[model samples]
Target: MGNLDGKVALVTGAGGMRGVGRATALKLAAQGADLAITDVRRDASDLPPAEVRQEWHSIDSVSDEVEALGRRCLPRYADLGISDEIQTLVRQVMEHYGRIDILINNARAVIGRDKVPVTDLEEEVWHHFLDINTTAVFLCTKFVGQEMVRQGSGGRIINIASNASKQASAMGAAYSASKFAVLGLTQASALDLAPHGITVNAVCPGPINTDRMSYWERSQADAAGVSLEEFRAQIVEQAGRATPLGRIAEAEDVANMVGFLVSDEANFITGQAYNVNGGLLFH
Candidate 1:
């Protein structure tokens, strides 16, 4: 039997075919969790071509996959930027799953004008990062933590933070700031929720092999005046030489960390920001 046989896990931003959210949901399900997965509504036009080619249909497909694992899945479409919508999402999860023992705050917005330098960053773009990345996590933790406290059985809250939260890079001020805020919030919430037997922690992944990496690669490629293909090759080779692990991370790598965090073994752990960055940030 899996460690999470009777647990219910709620995962946000789970639509991407090759994303940490999807991978985490699957990991928890494999451990015997029923799932409540969510993603914002998106136009087909906005999908990555490779995912589209694979018929990746966001939360619906994820729900199907979870159900196939012999677990119940409640799929939701929500705007995490709105507090009311988030409350609604939590309520829906409670209604469908009866309890939410694990909450994964994995939704993020990485592609925006916020990718520019701090000097060129717009107010809206900065808020865009805070709303989706930081505020949404806070709101989820708020509602879900309340539920966990009420249940009196303890719970797990895992925020999918980034290496950017620890080490700043060029032209990523807003993204870094938002993730930094999440790191702080993770520690604060961990302290607040610890007395209630709920543990809150952050998983910081760096240079992951996801569609988000493609966007980063494209931006770097443009900046370096090289083809995307060339830049990708350069990064992969450079990562091999620069990082201790000799390679970038896979979504499952991050998911595995999350799986451990929500397990019985992590009961003594809290208020921590774990790096799954291939040893990119040693400090």
Candidate 2:
């Protein structure tokens, strides 16, 4: 009896236990949508300590949670950066579910060696990030949008952008550039898909409480020669004070926004990017 009772949603990068992708999948599933979730095959040892402790088997565990909520789930492994893999993913979903009612483009390049001054960044790393962040988004949206158009009933496509979309990151030139392009793609795709009744929007989140943020924070802590514990506390305090809401955000906070955007409630909203930054940045 949920709003998306017969709908199917494809969420990429859903393997992270505390990531927005997993939360969004559960949110959409709770609202009655069958899920097709994908992520790169991962090793348990490489996961965050929390995930390892809890024995979270990435996408498999996520699928278990979705089915527990009484919604169907199709879990697959696809390196989003590979164009052929993405096409195969779409075809697999079509062959399995026969229709895709929503697409959550939540996968992106992981922040890493590229988190340095532009002058210090490697050309190879730059293209790698763009391939995963920008190119992958393009491929997913293109293929999925085609399916939605063919369906003729419209659909929802949500891109997990970043606050970096509007503001440049100090040591994140490649990351920021990718996100900026995502916003542009979102707007352009929104226009192209509008006539087809499909709504495309971007969710630009700020510092969130997730493993990805933890890794970034650790990098800073190491650079400053400070203890991870001390640096973590200090940054959280500073970020909380800077934000209007007086706190950082949880993964579910962004997921809640995604749930709303995909629902009928946001039917009239499209071609726009919403900053789910706890009021840290206002436009």
Candidate 3:
């Protein structure tokens, strides 16, 4: 029998093909947990020219995979950054699954325009990043924690932070600040929820090979006047060389960490930010 047999998990931002959310959902499902997977489900106009919209089938595809694993799946579309939408999402999950045993707050905001230097950053850009990255984490944890408490059975809440949470980035002030706040939320929530037997933690992933990273690479390459292929090659080489493990990470790598964090083996661990960055940063 699977470790998460008969449990229900709710994962956000699970639509992207190579994203941590998708990988985590599948991993959890394989462990026998029914899943409620959500995504924004529309192409952002701000995406790079080479970044095509995720086909509407993204969440459906994840659901199909979950079902194939013999676990129930509920696919929903919601913008987690919006308070009302998050409330509606929790309600839908509860109605569909009757309980929420795990919550992976994996949805995040990373606009290309926000990648500029601090001097050129706009007020709206900072707020936009915080709204989705930090604020949404709070809202989801607050609402979902309530449900977990009501059930009176301890649950796990894992926030998808980033390696940027530990240090500042040269031109990534907004993103970095928002992720730093995520770590704070994770720790503080872990304390408050401990009395109720709930555990809160954050997973800080390094540069995983995802569509979002590809878009960022394309933008950086254009700025450097290099072809996308050349930029990608240079970046892979640099990151691989810098990392102690001699390679960058894949989405499944981060998912593996999440899988362990939510399992019974990690029941004693809480209020921690686990880094899954191939030994890039020692903490």
- What TM-score would each prediction reach against the true structure? 0.92, 0.93, 0.92
TM-score of predicted structure 2 = 0.93
lDDT per residue (tens digit) for residues 94-156 in model 1: 988778899999999756456667888888988988999999999999999999999999999
Per-residue C-alpha lDDT of model 3 across residues 1-283, encoded as one tens digit per residue: 2399989999998987767889999999988799999988565543423344434366888899889999999999998778999999999999988999999999888556677889999999899899999999999999999999999999999999999999888989989999999999999999999998899999998877665544566778989999766787787778878899988888898888888989998989999999998898877
Q: How many residue pairs clash in model 2?
A: 0
Looking at model 2, the pairs that clash are: none
Across 178-208, the per-residue lDDT of candidate 2 in tens digits comes to 9899999999999999999999999999988
| C-alpha lDDT score of every prediction, in listed order | 0.88, 0.89, 0.87
Best by lDDT: 2
Q: lDDT for model 1, on a 0 to 1 scale? A: 0.88
lDDT of 2: 0.89
Candidate 1: stretches off by over 4 Å: 213-241
